[model samples]
Target chain A: MIARVVVVPRPQVADPQGITVARALAQLGFAEVRSVRVGKYLELELDGPPQDADRRIEEMCRKLLANPVIEDYHFSLEEATTQR
Target chain B: MIARVVVVPRPQVADPQGITVARALAQLGFAEVRSVRVGKYLELELDGPPQDADRRIEEMCRKLLANPVIEDYHFSLEEATTQR
Candidate 1:
C-alpha cells in the first residue's frame, strides 16, 4: 500500500516561512505573486490490505508524523499504483 | 498559483518511521503491504504570470522549503484551479 501525506499550517496560523518566500518571489520578478505557504509532503508504502490502513495511518500521523496543534495532515491509501 | 511540494526521504535513507507504520499496517491485517516510504506535499498560492514563477519558487524550495541533502520537492504554478 502507498500513503501520500501532506502536513500544512492551519489557515489561521502564522507562516513566516511562507511569507518570507512570497517576498522573495516578488523580488525575483514574480511581481504578481501574493502568498507562499510552505508545508510537508510524505508518501509511504506498506504491504497490506486496505481495510484498516486508514485508521492506523491516521493514528501514526497524529502520534508522530504531524503536530496536531499547529498543522493539518491529509493522506491517501492505495495499492502501489506507480513505480519510481 | 498553487505549488504542491513533496519532501521525501532519499531512496538510500533509512526511514524508521515508515518502517514502524508498515508494521502497524500489517498488524491491522493489511497483510499484503510490502514497503512504505513517507514524503511531504505542499500547496502554495501565488498570484503571478507563469513566466518566472517556477524559477523563483524553485529557489524558495531549495533555500527553505526543502532540505536537498535528504529530501526532494516538486510543485506547480497555476491560477487558483480549485477552491478549497
Candidate 2:
C-alpha cells in the first residue's frame, strides 16, 4: 500500500518560511499573492495488509512524522500498482 | 482564490531526508515501511480573478515554487471561503 501524508503547521502557529515565500512572490511581482503556508508531503510505500496499515500509519505519524504540539497531519492509503 | 501546490523531487533525484525517515521508522519497528519520499506542500492565497489566476500560478511555479532541473510541481485552485 501507499500512504500519502501531509504535515502542516497549525493555523495559529507562525510560519517564517511561508512569510518569506510570500514576500519573495510579492517582490517577484506576483502582487496578487496575499499569503502562503508551507508544509511537508510524504509518500510511504508499505508492505502490509490493509487492515493493519491504517493503524500503523497513524502511529507513525504521531511518533515520528508530525510534531503534535505545533502541527497537524492527515493521510490516505491506496493500493500500490507498481513495485518500487 | 487559493492555490495548493505540491512540489516533489524527481524520481531519479536523491532524497537523503526520505532515507533517514525510512531508517528511523524501521528502527522504531515499522518494518513494513518499504520506502519513503519527501516533498513540499504550499498553500497560496491570491487576490485575483479566476481566469487570470491559472496562468499566473503556472508562471509562479515555473519561476519560483519548483526547481525545473530537480523537482516537479502541480497545483489546484479553489474559491476562498474565509479571509486569511
Candidate 3:
C-alpha cells in the first residue's frame, strides 16, 4: 500500500520559514503574495493488505508519523482494495 | 482560501532523511517498517475570494510553490462557494 502523509503546522506556531519565503516573494515582485506556512509530506509504501491499511496507517501517524502538539497530519492509503 | 501544498521528491531522487528515519524507527522497535520517503507540506491562507482560488493556486504551485525539477505538488482550496 502507498501511504501519502501531509503534515501541517498549527496556525498559532511561529513560522519563520514561511515568513521568510513570503518576504522573498514580495521582494521578487510577487505583490499579491500574502502568507505561507511550511510543513512535511511523506510517502510510504507499507507492506500490508487493504483490509487493515487505513486503521494501521492512522495508528502509525498518531504514534510516530506526526507531532500532535505542533502539527496535524492525515494520510491516504491506496492500492489495497483489489489486492487479494 | 486555504492552500495546502504537498511536495514530494521524485522516486529517482535519493531520500536520505527518510532512510535515516526508517533506520531509527527500526532501532526503536518498529520492525514492520520497510521504506520511507520524506517530502514537504505547506499550507497557505490566501487573501482572496474562492472564485479564482483553484486556478491561482495551481499557477502558484507551477511557478514559485514547488520545485518541478525534483518535486511534485498538489493543493486544494476551500470556503468559497458559501462566501457571500
The model with the greatest lDDT is: 2
lDDT string for model 1 (B20-57, tens) is 86787577655655776766555667665667678867
The lDDT values for all models are 0.72, 0.94, 0.75
In the order shown, the chain A TM-scores of the predictions are: 0.88, 0.94, 0.85
lDDT of 3 by residue, A26-81 (tens): 77655555788888888776674568778777777777878899988888877734
Per-residue lDDT of model 1, residues A1-84, tens digit only: 677778889889998877877776677666665676677666766554578779877876787667899999888877767655
- C-alpha RMSD (angstroms) for model 3: 3.1
Q: Is the docking of candidate 3 incorrect, acceptable, medium or high quality?
A: medium
Error of 1 at A71 (Å): 1.5
Off by over 4 Å in 2: none
lDDT of 3: 0.75
Tell me which of candidates 1 and 2 scores higher on DockQ.
Answer: 2
Best to worst by DockQ, what's the order? Answer: 2, 3, 1
- The residue pairs found clashing in candidate 2 are none
Tell me each candidate's TM-score: 0.66, 0.96, 0.79
Q: How well is candidate 2 docked (DockQ)?
A: 0.92
Q: In candidate 3 chain B, what residue range of length 10 has the lowest lDDT sum? A: B75-84
Top-DockQ candidate index: 2
DockQ values of all predictions: 0.47, 0.92, 0.61
Second chain only: TM-score per model?
A: 0.85, 0.93, 0.84
Model 1 bad stretches (over 4 Å) = A81-84, B13-40, B50-71, B81-84
